[model samples]
Target: MSSDEVTDVIDPRPARRLDVPFQGFVVDMVSDEVDLGEAGGIVRREYVDHPGAVVVVALNEDGDVLLLRQYRHPVGAFLWEAPAGLLDLDGEDPHVAAARELAEEADMNAASWDVLLDLLPTPGGSNEAVRVYLARDLTPVPDDERHTREAEEADMVVVPVPLEEAAALALAGRLHNAATIAGVLAAAIGRASAWETLRPVDSPWEYRKN
Candidate 1:
């Protein structure tokens, strides 16, 4: 069968979904702890609530992927990551939000996009679902329309890195951001397969295989 005719069969298995009640946030706390049962059951759990977010993996016509290096206050250092942000509480769609974040952080707009995957960022603690999108057919736009926190805070610099290099970075322990690494590698593999299918051949691989 042709590559296009190939189908991925997925096993349908449901996870044990937990319904946890939200508690109030702490303005200040010295230490908070959770107690788990001896049998690996949760007796108590404490965590800060967070909303879902979207991560964009944008690729330009040259096949380079866009990335951002920004300072994370919590980490106290700069980290490479894809353009992403929390969803708008007013019920903004995740795909639209991903596109918006791409433009806001990278100053580029995608003509085509596909949602690669959605995953729970921290299943153990929080329920923040991060949706990853693969963006293509990129075009530059005005920087003034981009989102900004403060004049100096959260400076977003758009960097175009080759997809191969990005994947190498991830494997070499450079790309530490979970969402970004996952999204980039997914897109890279997809693009590679697409390129392979489109390559010119005498017999065409599909017929040869058959």
Candidate 2:
């Protein structure tokens, strides 16, 4: 095929009705039949219907990134991760969710924010889109105003790792959290480019919208 004819783009997904096989508290196992055009064919696919999420790569004046060591029951390990949360609240903006998670999980706030990266962590098995934000000019949340934690977050420990070191840890396969790895690497790239590639905090995210 000619280079001009080999362009990459998202073909319109075939219309399909989704049926829930198992509905859980926060997600559902959905099944659908998709038309893969003439060359391929129709195929049945099952995946987790996710509500999407946001991650905050909060950076201090020293360029160290805030991280939380939280116990993940599913993974059976404590992971060092950037402050993140699901977009479970009705009508909550992604940016607002990121800010809230930063304060709630990390006990901090950022004065500046920008879109660092967008990702589909498990495209083959889930439609879970994530938006990672670059948060700077950090300040601690007032003790009285701090959010009370529960469950997994109750014993979460806040830690600071330099952005460059975080990126290195990700490269070395030490950072296991998908969002944390992506966020720090993206932040490193953004910093190298003087953040010219960073998007506005309110940048349109069609993946989540759809």
Candidate 3:
């Protein structure tokens, strides 16, 4: 089976990076020297720097999951994804960011939240990480409370699809986007097995803790 089983216990070590000149809500590039005691002492790597992110697996009362279809310029394809966003707000709590993304991207709100899964897209090269939240107890944003969309957030299609169908699309690689693929399948298997609730919303993530 192709899988990444967690086997290393990272020892706390100091890291250093030189800032690159790029202006954006999230870091685009980084120069890093990370200490991996088990693999090697201190190895240098340069890759994209992501502020981490959140994916909202919001389920409506009708048992449908919210999703968005957006045009990705890089991939040159319209990708289906869950409501997600970067941790751009300084000192902002991750759960709050997740809620904000759900409202901004889907024009909806969730009253209940659970830490469904954690994702590290490129642990070997990038420190990017994301938390998937299972959001239930749905509510809609007031007409006057909708967010003004821009850039990638603008002109996207939002729809609700049944959770099982969504999972099948993901497992078949039709979903494509890492966040959507992970979020859909995790939520599906998790719900079937009554998944363990381990990490809290405020759990400290080591990948982005630096």
Candidate 4:
């Protein structure tokens, strides 16, 4: 079979299940889950349905990446990340949401954008797909009068980090967000054509001088 036509042969089995609904989210409970009959059973199992989001790795003419440090209530701490947000409740385009989020969260706009990668934040539990985009030729947008409750609660600080330095910080575990790390790595490795290369790969996160 062609590579594209190749498929896995998964055995089927009976399993117990439960669904717990919430006001804004739902929990799926599964017991006596399917066993592939492997020695380790399954390295991962269970899938949670989630609304996907987009992350923009926007770079300016000066070669600085736009990053945000926002206060996360769940973590009860400030975390650095690229501008990102979930699709609209009515189901909006992921790219459109990325552009809108860049504008809404950063007060910035990009002249061009290209998708770098689509990744699952947590495949084992959540089906949250995060689409990372490389944005170049940025333009600043006028501050709008619109904002969301989440935005209002977020004390967002926009900082421009040199691409090289950003990668280094990520390797040092200073940049903890998975999507941001993936986006930066994608840009550094030249997978993202919209970003200019500033270094080479010495490690998964370390960039070498080019």
lDDT of 1 by residue, 1-210 (tens): 789978544342323324434434421112223334465544434444455688888888888888898888767877899989776455566667777788778888888877666667665565456777888888887766656655423565678999999999999999889999998888877777773422111221110100
What digit string (tens of lDDT, one per residue) describes model 2 on residues 100-176?
99999999989999999899899899989899999999999999999999999999999889999999999999989
List ranges where model 2 is wrong by over 4 Å.
Answer: 1-10
lDDT, candidate 3, 1-210, per-residue tens: 345775556665777876554545566777767787876888877777777898999999987899999988988999989999888766778899999999999999998888888888888666788888988899999999999999987898999999999998887878899878888888888778776743567776665543
Which of 2 and 4 is ahead in lDDT? 2
Better structure of 1 and 4 per lDDT: 4
Clashes per prediction?
0, 0, 0, 1
Query: Considering every candidate listed, which one attains the maximal TM-score?
Result: 2
Question: Could you report the Cα RMSD, in angstroms, for every candidate shown?
Answer: 10.3, 2.1, 3.5, 8.5
Clashing pairs in 3: none
Candidate 3 accuracy as TM-score:
0.84
TM-score of each: 0.70, 0.93, 0.84, 0.72
Tell me the deviation in Å of residue 158 in model 2. 0.5
Clashing pairs in 4: 200-208
lDDT of 3 at 44: 74
Candidate 3 or 4, higher TM-score?
3
Mind sharing the TM-score for model 2?
A: 0.93
